[model samples]
Target: LVVFLFKQALTWIFGLLVVEKNLISYPYRLFFKKANKANFSFEYFIYPGLCALFSLYYPKNKSNLLKTLHFFISTSVIVIFEIIAVKYTKLIKYKKWTWYWSFITIWITDYVTHAFHKWFFKTKFHE
Candidate 1:
């Protein structure tokens, strides 16, 4: 799926940039012997996969309440998982970042990506 692929790539770019900037770190990662702090599993796969599904099924031309509710629900799920991961699995370690920061980033990224996806569909790959 182009949507999934694009979202996956975008997530990796943003996630890696965050790691490189030292805003966040991943002490535990997958598909690598040494942790690189990029969160390959989550960024390259999990989160984008979730995004793909969400985008595919997200209601269109919906009421503002529905859209807001959707965003809040998705953000809450992610934040809860992140909290657990940070506390129990030690998967993520925040240096200059905070949980609220992650929340806002996720919220903004989702909306922007969704907008791009809609535009791409409308343009039929012309852009």
Candidate 2:
């Protein structure tokens, strides 16, 4: 419960920072610029923010190898979803897939946040 709240807080903070910095426009500017039209919104930013927070709270009760595997699996799943959401659906669109850099930024942020949270909380594993 406490961890969940912490994750939410972190997500909100990052979301706000992205909005303030106008970094959210990077996707549309870099990739979706030549598209028939652009549909940029805060939703795109919020989802990744939440994903980062959730990744940070991933379970840590398995062996080290298992835990690492779980992290990779979890992160990959989120990245895949993001790709699909932005590419196939009207949820978000890009003129070109070169927008991969934006997704990479989100991925790295998620991994870093998860790692930072695990360290700050002293995540423990058990048999």
Give the top-scoring candidate (lDDT): 1
Count steric clashes of candidate 1.
0
Q: Residue 114 of model 1: what lDDT?
A: 87
Q: Give per-residue CA lDDT, model 1, range 1-127, as digits (tens).
A: 7667877778878888899999988876657637566877788778888888778878788998998888888878998899888788778887898889889988888888888888878845553
lDDT of each: 0.82, 0.54
Alpha carbon deviation, residue 96, candidate 1 (Å): 1.4
What clash count goes with each model?
0, 3
Model 1 RMSD in Å is 2.7
Q: State how far residue 118 of model 1 sits from its true place (Å).
A: 0.9
lDDT of 2 by residue, 1-127 (tens): 4444454555556644554455443344333445422222333454545565566556666688876676566657656776776766555444433345555655566666666666676758655
Q: Estimate each model's TM-score.
A: 0.87, 0.49
Top-TM-score candidate index: 1
